[model samples]
Target: MSIAAGGFTVMEAEDDYVEYVPVAKRRALEAQKILQRKGKSSSLEEDPEKAKLAEAKPSLLVKATQLKRDQPEISPTEQMVQQEKEMIEHLSDRKTLMSVRELAKGITYSEPLLTGWKPPLPIRRMSRKQCDLIRKQWHIIVDGEDILPPIKNFKDMRFPDPILKMLKAKGIVQPTPIQVQGLPVVLAGRDMIGIAFTGSGKTLVFVLPMIMVALQEEMMMPIAHGEGPFGLIVCPSRELARQTYEVIEQFLVPMREAGYPELRALLCIGGVDMRSQVEVVRKGVHIVVATPGRLKDMLAKKKMNLDNCRYLTLDEADRLVDLGFEDDIREVFDHFKAQRQTLLFSATMPTKIQNFARSALVKPITVNVGRAGAANLDVIQEVEYVKQEAKIVYLLECLQKTPPPVLIFCENKADVDDIHEYLLLKGVEAVAIHGGKDQEEREYAISSFKAGKKDVLVATDVASKGLDFPDIQHVINYDMPAEIENYVHRIGRTGRCGKTGIATTFINKNQSETTLLDLKHLLQEAKQRIPPVLAELNDPMEDIEAIASASGVKGCAYCGGLGHRIRDCPKLEHQKSMQIASSRRDYFGSGGYRGEI
Candidate 1:
């Protein structure tokens, strides 16, 4: 039985339709058409006008069938139409406003997005309130320039003699601001919380202190029992731990050759040879850089001990929470007993982290190198509002302009893969990395990117934290992250270590109002001027003074006082008023009598 045109079921004699399925003629027709499109012959192709006949044929068994005939002659115009259809399908994958330069096998050039689509404008601007705060900094910068380190002088900090010598030989004279403020306290064994944007030389702040401690320990004490790592550095992910480990390794080598060195270390991360890690641990390493999970696993099995854990560092503390490794963090903290000095560094510190901070540290000195998620002043932030359809087109244009190293942030793993594949098909060099990618592969892609081998990297939030690719110039939000906090880490990839960088976000009308508002809040808090288009978009801060004054809001909790807070209250103000009242009473012979000194 066959379904002719106009939905008629034609039941053919079994003998006549011997080669066809007995009752699946309808299913077979469309299937056959596709096969013919691929240049393969099908039973239905033999009957050129059979589909149009609209005649029913009886079902048949053991029916003999004719082979398909050639397709109708295609006109040049029809061929053009077919070619265009294919192109449209290809272009569908490469949307406008999304410049997808995937970093796979070196970025391949994909034809940019549709013509005539304008690059998007930024979604929102920094608020006016934030703008005012920024202007104040310039004044302070000028006034303080004389008393503070010059920009170049930052690198020439008065580090300790040995550390200074090591830095000079390594050509690392100037300290990044994070290093400037953070290193001192960290080296002092003061538990510190470091909050700086990504790429702000935050690693060095902790690394320098770690080295100093390691050196001090080397000088004062003999090697500890077991291959237990003396210094424990924990991160959220394997890639980050490895990345940090490698970076610290470079600085450590020079120090090792020069002074109290011999700093053996164990890498305890998942997805590697466990026995090998254990062997290294058995050999007594100086530092153990690890992901929380593998470290916890080893500790649970009693594989290592922190009997000598003197210095502890948690990198990307916020990311550790995000990765659902909060328990592991607690365990890592619990594992290290005694009065070990600890350091926790994160790009942003939410309330939850503050809770963790309260539990982990002993009256730690807090250090905020930058506002949480604030755009680095050194980085240029460009906003472009683009429609999803036009995003790929804008991306292509953006890519053509600057082939600089770029970190592309996608909202999800699926999007990362889809965008990565589409860019690849479009001949754009790119690779997709999510939590899904194997650790080694992720490392390879990141390493390739950092080495200046890959032009673009498509990643999820994992790469947004603790990534130290200082040369990254453009951070393109192929899609805005749902969480505004992630936005801070994303742009932070560039403009790090005090280098100028650029961040461009593509927005469309469909861009969430809430997202733009949050972004505006973030940028404004960072002290950037709001884009004119979004000037009115910012919600004005409520006039809180009236509310404050009506209830004596400024009164100190410690003392029932007006015109002053108890803690920092000026005694002279009350004393001066009392004198005035007393003088008036004396002149009038009234009850008031106190006088100023």
Candidate 2:
């Protein structure tokens, strides 16, 4: 019934147009300010007398001199741009993302205030060669020598032939831990809750099973053609939805090629054309991938129907919980039939989500491959203490020296822009991804980055979970995370699949007081070397890197101490968490009926 055995899938994406919503709006004002700054620089060059007077001022003289030392040799205007960017950073509250972008787009010395019109941005894409070159550089940096864990093959697993075909085409010969443990439960028509780290191939886990159900339906009604998907995939961000959509499309290719390929796909996300999206739904799609808010709009307009949905996959389930999508998610679940299959995937399971998962799944199976609350030690952690203004310089210098395929994680979207624009001005190959971008542009940014067209990706919490970047060599925490758990997941991007990677974080003086305390505790537990500032308040260190080493040492193969390997241990290896959680339903839904086999 499905071409999954061949690997191409019918997928979805925002068609094209994007709207300018305030929260999701691009900083047109900021972009205009930068342009004005440029114009001012030109004026300075044109007027020698004015330039001489400007440099004569004591404040300006010291700044120009500092800029000369801190930044790479560039034109005078470029220098001004760098200095202005630094000044603006101090003025931001660090509370909101849009504000950060506005701050980043500040004017040069020429234009004092941020008022002016900037042209609308046009679509842009990178050449394949440029992207391919970046992709190829990854193997050199990632470490996978100890990564010989057996690939989980569920060939004994039962599924429709269509799925088999799709897998063959996509080259997914084996299931990852997430796919292997989670799929069969779902295939048996049961709900599932999966908790694992990033880069664990979480996407394929639920995607393949949904494809199978679609395939099975096609077989029952051989000539039914594309009645479309019996599934809905709700994601946290547009970029992730687009990424998932593209991957799904790849799986749908053979179906389209085999005929009866009118399998429709629709995308509903903020900052994009809603009416057009509604039209696509009216035209009919087999599946819908969306952010919660946009879907609310679609449902309000009567353009989407969840009444027929028999299955749902929640990606980044924890993040969705964090983003306050509970009510929307509940609304989505309420629209589904009582016999629906719900699959929830997350990197870490907070108790709040555990309760929600229990409520949603009917006797669901819980799979834990990496163990409970375990940090993936594959990524090497590195740290530096510096002034807030120095961060712009530190990041640029770091990239120049160890520049490899890298992902930069920021505490917030504003910080994402701060790092993103700093890199752009320095001519570093980078792009930013956050909820702020319209759905289409977000998708484009991810595609371009994955294609290896980009060297560095500056992202906020958006990229912190449920993402895969197989060749990433480095993950930089531009600022330390407020939550210890986020730190565990953010750096995990690098050391995936047993590959060795590195993570670097910058801790500045102006960090929020509460966040700094939490960060200090986390670094201490990790057993990393804490800076001298905290030495007096800290306990005596048995090890040199007292602060960061506490949680970092690989549990003793013997005594479970970090310093010693298991080779010297006298005890046998022991397993941690149970492989599954007993998924028992509390009570049957009123007037519910079992699904037909």
lDDT of each: 0.62, 0.60
Candidate 2: Cα lDDT at 244: 82
How high is the lDDT of residue 309 in model 1?
A: 79
Predicted structure with the largest lDDT when compared to the true one: 1
Off by over 4 Å in 1: 1-166, 169-171, 509-511, 525-597
lDDT of 2 at 375: 55
Q: How close is candidate 1 to the true structure, as a TM-score?
A: 0.63
Point out where model 2 deviates above 4 Å: 1-151, 159-171, 222-229, 258-262, 439-441, 509-597
Count of clashes, each model: 54, 43
Who wins the TM-score comparison? 1
Kindly list the per-residue Cα lDDT of model 2 for residues 290-381, writing each as its tens digit: 88878766776666767656778888886775565655776665444334667788776543355556643555566655533345656667
Candidate 1 C-alpha error for residue 387, in Å: 1.6
Worst 10 residues of 1 by lDDT: 140-149
